[model samples]
Target: MGTLDSDDLKSGVDLKSQTDDVSLVDERTAEQKKIDDWLPITSSRNAKWYYAAFHNVTAMVGAGVLSLPYAMSNLGWGPGVVILILSWVITLYTLWQMVEMHEMVPGKRFDRYHELGQEAFGEKLGLYIVVPQQLICEVGVDIVYMVTGGASLKKIHDIIWDGAPKIKTTYFIMIFASVHFVLSHLPNFNSISGVSLAAAVMSLTYSTIAWSASIHKGMQQNVEYGYKGKDRAETTFNFFTALGDVAFAYAGHNVVLEIQATIPSTPEKPSKGPMWRGVLVAYIVVALCYFPVALIGYYMFGNEVDDNILISLNKPKWLIAAANFFVVIHVIGSYQIYAMPVFDMIETLLVKKLKFKPTFALRFISRNIYVAFTMFVAITFPFFGGLLGFFGGFAFAPTTYFLPCIMWLAIYKPKRFSLSWCTNWICIFLGLCLMILSPIGGLQNIIKKAKDYKFYN
Candidate 1:
């Protein structure tokens, strides 16, 4: 044979070695080489940043937002602004840090917080701790949405019918449950973004109505329009209640990774840039809508503000009816978005643990069953205030504030007492403090109002 070049000899040896190494790789590892094998290439992956941003906005702006003014009323305007701004900053920072952790996996994407937790800590901790927290928070939120949506629908029904036989809120909730069960059948998170966009608009619509109504009410002769909290001792106790409210308002962190995974990824431009762009734009929109509604609402209602400022509005029946309709629509959409993760987790477990293939019939039946279960819970507890306090105190502090920091430290293992280390520790400390205090405050507040609690009243 003719003398071969040295380059040919080297290439031949490399090819042989690569072929030999292939057998050592596991089937899962081999399948991961083709991203399509793990994740479906669907329209859900084709979302642009603004579309993604709308989902984030819808996720963040929900029933909890109506509580903001009440939160601010407990704390004065100055302190309210400080707490809101600080919460926003800390959440944003932790969110960014989460994205950073997400990128460390090179070609892989984390589609859930539990995945991130598993990678950072261990599979047991991830599956048991993080997963349960997500389920409780998300399921709890869906229950709240149902309760609030029923109230809104009832308000609209009353306004239109004028002395129509007063149907129990349970009837309205059952009606909404039927509608939401249908909507929940939408295949994936990306597909739900369309509904989320409408929901975002609905939230903005009602928020604008509430804000204008508040301004109009405050400007009327004889109405006071400034810092309104009195009863120093009462305010002090309620201030912790406010912390949980604001925390619940920002409780979209559990699904951030799920939303992030919906954006299409390319080798040149990873999901990181798009994720950050979408989140930043969404938060800016959230702040604009949230601050005005909360501030103006508090200014108008003062200490008399209801947990839901919409109820406290002195607007005409038609206007309040319109706002309530919008609230119902927004929550209707939001309930599905939040509930999707729980559905996904359960479906995945069934397929993986029980070897149940993900057929359309299975998916349809399972999701419908899940929706019915949540409806049952909502009907049973009609304890809106208590649920909010319990879920917000128990879940929001840890998921939104505490865990993100610790996860970052666990992943990066930064130098001892370095800026990263110190910052994360401080976050952990603050989160722990909130976790301990908020629940106590919220439980007490709930107890104080327990006598008024009724099931589907």
Candidate 2:
């Protein structure tokens, strides 16, 4: 009787301990669920695939497109076309890889880029590698857009009233950023779909106007298809910088996984199918926007082309003004698309790492601060071309060109001699070169510009 009672008491204690553990886990998980529900990236899951399409269109085709012609001037005819096409195909492949990887594990979704990174690289290492590059890419793009938006606003003012009192570009950048102060508060990706779609339409609109206007202006007198650099060393540096510009133009990959996370997924259908479809649509639109603006703009202006093609086309005052207006609208949407991820990152750090409550006050203060920071940077530097090249190679190249390939190889691990392996290795090699070389030229160009530039002018 004594032995039986002892055995029963031990069994009861074990059961009670297990039950308490279960209860604690359940409570912790429920709290996590609430936090996820409030964060912008995870707050919604009903977005359609076309939302991916326009969101991507808005993200990829921003101020960078305007610089394509200038990139061609530095790269010249043969190399420029080859590089542009290669980037399109390579980025598309990597983007498809990301979409596939989004749900590769089955029954779970990698809702953010870093989550996918953690799956490939260990948890801490993954955050270290991906988060910094992703932040630089997103935040860098937002800052560039601020400069682009402000410049476009200034263009409109110039065209509308050629001799009117000039407002400082600083004020224009500030005005552009003010719009985000309100739009940034929207809870999630799906909520901004309408704005994204409008931005998409504006991208196509301005691109068409850009190319058509270039044709309307006809070929310039003594247009030199020759390289702009006066010496071999200068030519080499400009070539590298141009690569960064092209890399910047194709920078949709940084947010591709996040875009995929918005789509509804199921075992029966999978999110990749719809997401891939949207990617195809987005790529087609990209090709349309990129090739014409590049080829035609370069053909018309050649070595003398302005860093921004719109600045080169000054005829037909109303039409040029309209294009500038479209640019402002497109970048307005672009800024939000990129800023969404940064917002999520900030909010995540506050709530999860810092233990701040998820509240309106926290969100309001944090997001506003971010906007102000970017605005201040934009006003201070305002070197649109240099900024694009530097950020594009430093951050965009890895995220768009090679990071996905690295992750795919790491996770999937195709046979060493296989076609998949070779293709990925080629992408990795090219991306690594772009990452290494492009920034050197970009820094040189920024230095050159800074020598003659005035701050906040």
User: Where does model 1 exceed 4 Å of error?
Assistant: 1-26, 29-44, 220-233
lDDT of each model, Cα atoms only? 0.79, 0.90
Candidate 1 lDDT by residue in tens digits, 71-173: 8877777888888888888888888887667667865777678999998889897777798788878988998888888878888998889988899989888
Q: Residue 125 in candidate 1 has what lDDT?
A: 77
Evaluated with TM-score, which candidate comes out highest?
2
Residue 266, candidate 2: Cα error in Å is: 0.9
Which residue pairs collide in model 2, if any? none
- For 247-351, candidate 2 gives per-residue lDDT tens digits of 889888888888888998878989999899999999999999999999999999999999889889988889999999999999989988999888999999999
Question: Which 10 consecutive residues of model 2 have the lowest summed lDDT?
Answer: 384-393
Superposed Cα RMSD, model 1: 3.5
Residue 219 deviation, candidate 2, in Å?
1.8
